[model samples]
Target: MNVFYEEDGGFKVGAVLADNTTSLQVEAPHGKRSKIKAGTVLLKFEKPALSEFMEQAQHVADELDADFLWECSNQDEFGFADLGLEYFGHAPSTVEAAGLLIKLHGSPMHFYKKGKGHYKAAPEESLKAALASVERKRLQALQQAEYTAQLTGFSCPEALLPQINMLLYRPDKNTIEYKALEQACHDTGLTPPKLLEKCGAIPSSHDYHFNAFLFEHFPKGIEFGEIGEFDIPQDLPESNVSAFSIDDATTTEIDDAFSLIHLPNGNWQVGIHIAAPALGFGPGSRLDEIALERLSTVYMPGNKITMLPDALVNAYTLEATKSCPALSMYLEIESADYSVVSSVTRIERVKIAANLRHDTLEPLFNEDTLARGGPDYPFKKELGILWELANRLEIGRGKQGSNIGTDYSFVVKDDRIAITDRKRGNPIDKVVSELMIYVNSRWAKMLSEKGVAGVFRSQFNGKVRLSTTPGKHIGLGVDQYAWASSPLRRSMDLLNQRQLIALVRGEPAPYASNSEVLLGAVSDFELASEAYNSFQRNMERYWCLRYVLQEGINEASATVLKENLIRLDTLPLVTRVPSMPELPPGTQVQVALSNVELLDLAFGCEFKHRIELQ
Candidate 1:
């Protein structure tokens, strides 16, 4: 006898081998044998074979109308055979009963299973809603297919234009645009950015990278609207010294400058003046809030997003010919030796005499010119005096200047670039760097002595950190150092400047010790500053490759940094040269560059011959 039974909540047919009272030993159609309970047995037939019965029942199930079956089903639960009998208007054959069971099992939405071979009809409302959802999804699948077809042909669908940033930077996988973009990427083996660029969706390669950064960092866009008007301080005592700033020609928000006064007592009074914007913008003010959100100015190869608006920067920046409010550190150094006899910090208006550009001044005043007594130039006398003091300050630090290697300044204009190479520890660099370091260290000391809290830059054991407590910055060979000079560009500098101004003016400090705002700003600035610096380095690297392609540098020399890593001689670029022979660091090797991908910001560097042996 052939029996139809349920096993593991599924229908199966097996041949009974030995029948017991309540159980049977049966062999399945595939010849596997098992003991079964009598209660699990649904039917027993003698005529048709088990294999043919299932195949014929499936055909009948295919022919059945699920909607019609659902309508014909009784509201209360009934067995499949009873429903089959009700629909067929007769006592169902065993095959017909099994076909009804198959139909009911297939249409889960139309019918819900209650017990073995027993079924219940779904409610009309739920059935309609489920059908509508399935139909909508089916239509969306068809639309996705159409969009993919358009993208496959290098044509962007109109629907994807609105979601270009989303598709490139942060895609929502559930949306149809992203689905089509993913499918197109899989088909073409091209990245989404490349595919979109091919379809003319991306206008420029520069914008592609710029927009990605903006989307992640400046989601609302880099705009400062209606932050209120800024007031330039009018009632400030003007200084006698005429100051001049040294920065790149493109710099507009000039921060630090210098001045000199010959005292009658054979001592030189030198002023390291910093543009003081903190005096204008207090904590929780509009400009302060904007500066807080920005944290620091974002710099790339050719452009920058300033922490302050142009109007405010123009007012506060120590522009030439303007008597601007500044926080000055006047150092009284004896003429016989460049030692700080005394130092004073005060807030006053200092006349900015000139804005010296590196391109113009570097030629007149450099290491060679300083050693040989330069051909006459603007601020030559003042710079020479300051250069002496800078050297003295460097000697006081117990080290030469922070000498590493070469530093490149990038200038980009209308897609053209110029990268000027300069040595790190030149006279121009030393003078500016040493004075800034001295003032930062001196002001850090003053703030600590006065019981004022300030954000200090501390380094120990090769790791750098921001802390409130005064500690030794072993790198600079200083007891403590804080950034208080560049308030026009950096928020932390602005914060420290606020504290220093309070201490110098004998006013209550703005931030209390261990205040949440102070602590949070320290940590937040570290994270934001690191991210901005990394982005600047990466963008500079991208430009280096662009320079390679533009200059057609096919073969170049590089010094080995590690096993396979090399630093190019002409460009500030580091890469892994392929198939490099084992060599020690500082061994120069010739390399061939090829396959520069701007979008990927990568280069294929091949090892040539060793340029410098052992």
Candidate 2:
């Protein structure tokens, strides 16, 4: 006998092979045998063949209107056979019962299944809401298909334009737009940024990379909000000597300056004057909070986000002709050997006599010019004296002060980039670096000696870190180096300056021994400083690639660092050449450049020939 049964939420017709009261062994129309419960068997028939039963039943189910069937049923639960009998106005045929069951099971919005074959009509309101949801989903599917087509066709829909950054940076996976973009990316074998760029959604590659960084790091935006002003300190004593600053022309946050005074005992009193923003605001102040949040000034090739507001930077930066409040460290050096005889730290306002720029000063103050000692310029004598003292300080620290390699500086103007290289350990660099290192080391030693907590930059076993505890910075050849010089640029410097100020004033230290605040600042500053430096490096790399493209150069010179890895000679760019032949490290080579992808910050290159050293 043929039996119509419900299995796995569907109706099927099978021929019974062995019949049991509780369960039956039946062979389906496809000749597949399965064991079924007797309760799951909804109907028993004999006339129609098993193959013909389901097809005919499905036709009948399709012909029936589910809404009409729902309307005909009562609110109380009833079996499908009973409903079919009531609707057909007769003892229902097996096919009619199976078809009605099929319709009732399929149209869940109209009727909800209760038991094996029993069903109940859905409530009016619930059925309407369910139907509306289905319709909305259907429409959304169509819209998603449309967006997918547009994206795959290299056209961005207007709806997706406003959300381009969001889609690229932080995507909501559940949205249809994101799903469409995801599908398009999969179809085109491209990333979200590449696909968006293809669709004309990305106007500038530079902005794309820059904006992604901003989105991740500065989610609230780079602009400083309504931090109420604080008064600049006015009661500080002014220093007797005039100070001069040497920095790049682009520098506006003039952190550290220098002063020279000839003392009576044939000695020189050299002052390392640091711009003291800590004087204007103390711990827990609004400005302090701002500085702590930013941690350090974020620098790129052509731009920077200052740690403090422009107004505060202006008030504190030791600009030329301004008597800026400074945390000055004075070292009395005996003229015979340029050795420090005594050292003292004080809070004073120092007159900035000049802001010497590297571009102007390097021409007159470099190694060759200093050795010749003929071409004289403003502050040349002071710079010479400082150079001598810097040498003495370097020698005292047991450092040979070797020039490792070239340091590249990038200047961007009107979408054009100029990458210039300066040899490391130049006299200007040595003087500034040595003095800053000395001052930082001195302040850190003072803080440690006074039992005050401060953030220090320490290096041990080739690893560098920030800590409240004092340790040796083997790289700088210093016992303990706290960043107390660039108070206008770094949060650690500012915090260290505060501790040093309190210690020098004989007042209670703002951060006590093992203070959580100091420790937390060290941890937080390390993380932020690394992130800022990485961003700076990436932006520098971006501009290096920009400079290459801007100059329309095809062939370039490179020094191989490892197998297939090369650094460009003219710019600070490092890339791999897959087509390059195996070569040793430091081998110079000529390479042909092609396919520069700014979005990916990558390029394709082929090695041409080895360049022999002169």
Candidate 3:
């Protein structure tokens, strides 16, 4: 006897070896033997042969109309053979019964299985909804294929234009657009950004990186909307010294300046003046809230996002010829040794003598000029004395003031980049850095002594961190350091300035020691500041690549830092050459650059030859 049975959710035909009444031992057409339950057998037939039975039944099953079968059936559950008999107008033959069973089993949308060999016609509404869903999926599959084809052909689909940033930065993998992009990326063996760039989806690589950062950090926008008027302090006492600021030409937030007075007793009274934005607004105010949210000014290659509004920065910036409100730290130093005899902190307005720029000032006030000592410039006498005092301060800190490396500055104008390198630890750097360090350390000490709370920057065991508790900064060689110098650029500095002002006036500090608010601000500032700095570094790298392309640089010199890592000599670019041979660190070599991918901010390089040192 031949039997058609449901096994493992599929239909099969087998010839019976033995019938035990409850179970049958059968051999399949291919000679494989198996035992199946009697209840699973849908039909028994002795046809032309077992081998030909399945193919014939499948053909018949394919020829049957599933909709006609469903329409002929009643809503109640019934056996397939009974439905076949009803449709055929007589008892069904074995072949017809088997074909009907196969058709019913396959057409699940038309009929739902109730038990072995039993089924019920699906409800009209449910069946229609299921068919519609299947059709929709089929259409979506076709659309996805079309999108994939377009992307593979270096063309972006119109549907994916609005979602380009999300697809590149943070993709929702479940969406069909993302799926198509993923498929295209895999097919081309390229990253999403590179593939998109090839498709002309990314118009500007610079804007690509910039927009990605803004999308993450400043999602709403970079606009400072409708800031209310805030009072600028005008009642402060004016100091008896003419102060001057030294900064970059592009700088608009002039936070710190310097002054000098020759005392009649052969002592020099030096003044370190910091712009006092804290006096215009207090903690928990609207401006303070805005500053706290931004945390710090975000700097990139050619631009910056200021933490404070332009109006507030202009009102408090130490501009030339303006007596701006300041937090001044006066040091009475003995002229013979350049050592501080007494130091005092006061709030006053200091007359601005000038705003000196580095490009113009460095040529005249550098190491060689100081040695010759004849070229006269504005505030040259004060700067010369301050430079001497800075050297003495460096010696007092037990620092040798050796040059560390080169510092690169990027200037971008009209989409062109100019990268210039300045030697670290130069005379101008030492003077500004030492004086800022002195003021920060002294202010931290004063806050600690007066039992006031403030934010401090500390380094120990090669790790640097911010905290409310005062601690030594081993990196700066300071006893205790707080960033109280740039109130217009940093939120933490503004907070510390508020505390310092309160201490100077004998008023209550804005934040209490060990307060959750203070601790939370420290943690948030650390995270935001690090994020800002990382973005800055990435932008700098982007500009470095742009500079390479702009200057038509193909071959360049680099100093090897590790096995394959090297730092470019002309620009602040560090990259790896996979083809490079094993060389010691600090070995100079020439490398050939190729395949610069801006969207990914990377390049390919080949090792050329080693550069011998002179």
TM-score of each: 0.95, 0.96, 0.92
Candidate 3: C-alpha lDDT: 0.91
Report the Cα lDDT for residue 10, model 3: 93
Global CA lDDT computed for model 2 = 0.89
lDDT of each: 0.89, 0.89, 0.91
Model 1, 274-304: lDDT tens per residue? 9999878788889988988899999998999
- Model 2, 363-479: lDDT tens digits are 889999988885869988889999999999998888875545799888889988888999989999999999988999998899888778888789999999888889999988889
In candidate 2, position 386 carries an lDDT of 97
Which prediction has more favorable TM-score, 1 or 2? Answer: 2
- Kindly state the number of residue pairs that clash in model 1: 0
Give the best candidate by TM-score. Answer: 2
Give the per-residue lDDT of model 3 (tens digit) for 77-193.
Answer: 998878988988989787778888889999999999999889999999999998999899899889999999999999999999999989988899988899999999999998898
Query: What's the true lDDT of residue 466 in model 2?
Result: 83
